[model samples]
Target: MAGLAIPTWDPETALLIGTILLEAIVLYVGYGGLERIVGPRLLKLVVGGE
Candidate 1:
């Protein structure tokens, strides 16, 4: 508990963190769509099976 320190809010830090979160969400959705389109075929090819 002694080592733990809570972060104080700063507008710039908040905006930066928000931007990173947005980017992560967008990337997740984009990759998910790509996976849905071709993931099974890719897995089969890697596994050497139909």
Candidate 2:
């Protein structure tokens, strides 16, 4: 099937895949940073404590 065909190396395909990977990495890091900044406070609120 065409959908199951092995990918051919192409600059455009490489760039598109690289961009998606980069975006995923960036989102992961950003969310991790935000969690580090706010996670404790959020947890405290949820658990109802000081």
Q: Write the per-residue lDDT of candidate 2 for residues 1-50, one digit (tens) a residue.
A: 46898768999989999999999999999999999999999999999988
Reference-based TM-score of each model? 0.64, 0.76
* TM-score, cand. 2: 0.76
1-50 in candidate 1: lDDT tens per residue?
79689878999999999999999999999999999989998999999887
In model 2, the runs with Cα more than 4 Å from the true position are: 1-7
How much is 20 displaced in model 1, in angstroms?
0.8
Error of 2 at 9 (Å): 1.0
